[model samples]
Target chain A: MLKPLGDRILVKVDEEKEQTVGGIVLANNAKEKPQTGEVVAIGTGERTPDGKDIPMTIKKGDKVIYDKYAGSEVKYDGQDYLVMHEKDVMAIVE
Target chain B: MLKPLGDRILVKVDEEKEQTVGGIVLANNAKEKPQTGEVVAIGTGERTPDGKDIPMTIKKGDKVIYDKYAGSEVKYDGQDYLVMHEKDVMAIVE
Candidate 1:
C-alpha cells in the first residue's frame, strides 16, 4: 500500500474530465490534471510548536478539492496517486 | 509581478530538465515536470490561532526544492509559475 508520511495525504483523483463546451475532448496536451479527489490515506497530524499532536481535520474517504498542481504524483500498484500536504487541500467536498 | 497572496508562494521553476540519462533525451511523454525552482515571491505569514502573524520562513530569491507536481501551474505575463502553499514547500536550497 502507498502511504504518505508526515502531513502528506494520498488522494485518488476522480477522472471525470472528459467533455468540453463544444463536446470535444479537451486538450490533454496542456491540461494540468485534476484537482478533486477522494482521500485514500492521510498522514499523521502535524506536531504543534509545543510538541502536541494536532489531529487532522480530514480522514480517509473524505472527498476534497485541492490545488490542481498541489502534490507529488507517484505510481503505485499500477495506479496513480497524489501525495499532498494537508494545508494544500482547499476545501472538503460534500 | 506575480505576487501570490496568503500562504501561496510563487516559484520560478528552474528550467534545467533538458538532459539525458543515457545521453538520449528522456521521453517527455511520461516524465513529470521539474521540482526545483527559485522563490520569486512568497506569501504573507500565516495567522496563528491567537491571531498573531507567524512570520514565513521563506523569502524571495531563495532557491528551493519542492515535491514534484506540488503546486498549481499558472501562465501569467507569458511565463510559467507555480503557486504553492507554504507547507507544500519542502526544503530551502542554498
Candidate 2:
C-alpha cells in the first residue's frame, strides 16, 4: 500500500468499462481506460515554503473529482496509484 | 469564468454518459454520473496556517483525477463547476 505525503493523495482507479455499459465490446486497443478513481489514501497536509503546517479539508475514504490529467502516477506493489496535491481536487460527491 | 483562489481549482465536469461506452441505455435513475472532470482553472497556490505562500505543482489546463467525493460544486453562469484544494488532486495525465 502506498502512502501519500503532504497534502497529496493516493487513488485506486475504478475500471473504466463494464459489460453493462457497452454494446460493441470494444477491444483493448480501442478501449479507453478510465481516468477517474477512488481515494485510497490522503496526505498529512500541506507545507509552507517556510515549513509551516497547513490543515487539509479532506480525509481518508472520501470520494472526489478532479482534472483528468493531473498529478504524478506511480506503480507500487504491482498496482497503479496516483499521488497529487489536494488543490487539484475539484469536487466532493454529495 | 470562475477563478479559483489559494490552492483551490475549478473544473468543468464531462458528461458521464456516452454512447461509445454503453449499450443498455440505462435510465437516468440507473445511470451513474462521471465524477471525473477537466481542469478549467487553478488556484494560485496553498497558504500556510500562518498565511505564508506555498507553490503549487499543478497549473491551469492540466487534467487530474481525485477522490470521487471531495469538493464543493457551484453553479456559475448556468454551468457546473467544482472548487477544491490542490492537495486533493491524485494524478496528472501524461
Candidate 3:
C-alpha cells in the first residue's frame, strides 16, 4: 500500500473526454489536461508552527478538482496517480 | 481597488528569472511560467453546504505557490495579477 505522508494525497485522475462542447474531435495534442480526480489516500494532517495538527477536510473517495500543475505524477501498478499537497485541491464535488 | 469574491484571491506574480541554475540564459519563449506570487486581495470565505462561511488562512502580502494554470489573468493598472481560488494556492512560502 502506498501511504502518503505530511498532508499529501493520492488522486486517480478521470478519463479524458475526446469531444468538445461543439462536438469537435480534439486530437490528443489539443486536449487540455484534466483537473478532476477521485481521492485514493490521504495523510492525517499537516503540522503547524505550534506543533498542532490541522486536520484535513478532504477524505478518501471524494471527487475533487485540483490545480493543473500541482502534483508529482506517478504510475503505480499500471494506474496513474497524482501525489500533491492537500492545499492544491480546489474543491470537493458533493 | 479590485476585490475578490467568494474564496477568490488576487496575486501579484514575481518577476521572471532570465538565467537558470546552470547560468544558461533562457529566452522568454523558453522560460517556464512561474507559480509563486504575493497575495494582494482575498475574499471573505467560501460558504459551506450548510451555509456557514469557511474563513481563509491566506492573507494579503503572503507569498504563495499556486497551480500553474489555476487562475484568470488580469492586468490592473499596468500590473499583472492572477485571480484564482484559494484552493489553487499550494503553499505559503514561509
Candidate 4:
C-alpha cells in the first residue's frame, strides 16, 4: 500500500489482452496507445499558492484512462503500478 | 506584440549561430538542445483553485532558458516567437 504524495496517483494497470487478427497475435512494439487503469491510491491533492488544498477529481476504484508516456512505473509487492500526477489522467471510464 | 494567456509567457527566440569547426559549419538536425530567449510579454498569472492569483516568477525583458519542445511556435510581424507556460522556463539568465 503505497501512499502517493501531493497530486500524485497510484494506479494498477489493467491487463491488456493481446490483439489477434485471424488467430495471429499482433506484436505491440509501439506503446503509444492510451492505457486504462484503476485508481489504487490518491494523494491529498495539489496546493494553491496560498496552500489551500485542491480537491482531486478521481478517487479510489475509479477506472481512468491515461496517456501512454505519462507517469513512472513502479513495482510493489510483485505488482506493477504507475505513479503519475492527476493531470496525466485523461478521463474516467463510465 | 502578442499578449500571452494565463500562465503563458511570450518569448523572442535568440538566433542560434551555426556551429563551425575549422571554418566548416556542422548541420544540426536534432533540435533537442535547450534554447535561450528574451521574454516579451506574459499573462496576468495562473489562478488558484479558489481563484487567487499565483504570481509569475519571470517578467518581461528577462532572458530565459527553456526546454526545446516546450511551447507553441508563433510568427508575429515577420518575427518568430514562442508562447509557453512559465513553468517551461528553466531559469533566468542574470
Q: Looking at model 2 chain B, which ten-residue stretch has the lowest summed lDDT?
A: B26-35
Residue range A1-94, candidate 2, lDDT tens digits: 4556577887776666654434666446564432567788876676667755688887777777767776666655677766767888787665
lDDT of 2 by residue, B1-94 (tens): 6788888989777666554435656445463322556788887776778677677766777766656666898999999888878767655544
Tens-place lDDT digits, model 1, residues A1-94: 6545547788898887676867777756575654799998876666454434468889999999998878777555677777788999999988
Cα deviation in Å at residue B22, candidate 1? 17
Pairs with steric clashes in candidate 1: A69-B71, A71-B70
The better-scoring model by lDDT among 1 and 2 is 1
Could you tell me which 10 consecutive residues in candidate 4 chain A have the lowest summed lDDT?
A: A44-53
- Flag regions of model 1 displaced more than 4 Å: A20-24, A28-34, B1-94
Candidate 3 structure quality by residue, lDDT tens digits, A30-62: 545648999988865774544355898899999
Clashing pairs in 3: none
The numbered model that scores best in lDDT is 4
**Decreasing TM-score order of the candidates:** 3, 4, 2, 1
lDDT by residue (B2-46, candidate 4, tens digit) is: 989888999999998888999999889574456778999999888
Model 3 ranges off by over 4 Å: A1-70, A73-83, A86-94, B20-25, B28-34
Residue B23 lDDT (model 3):
82
How does candidate 4 fare on TM-score?
0.50
DockQ, 0 to 1 scale, candidate 4? 0.04
DockQ of each: 0.05, 0.08, 0.02, 0.04
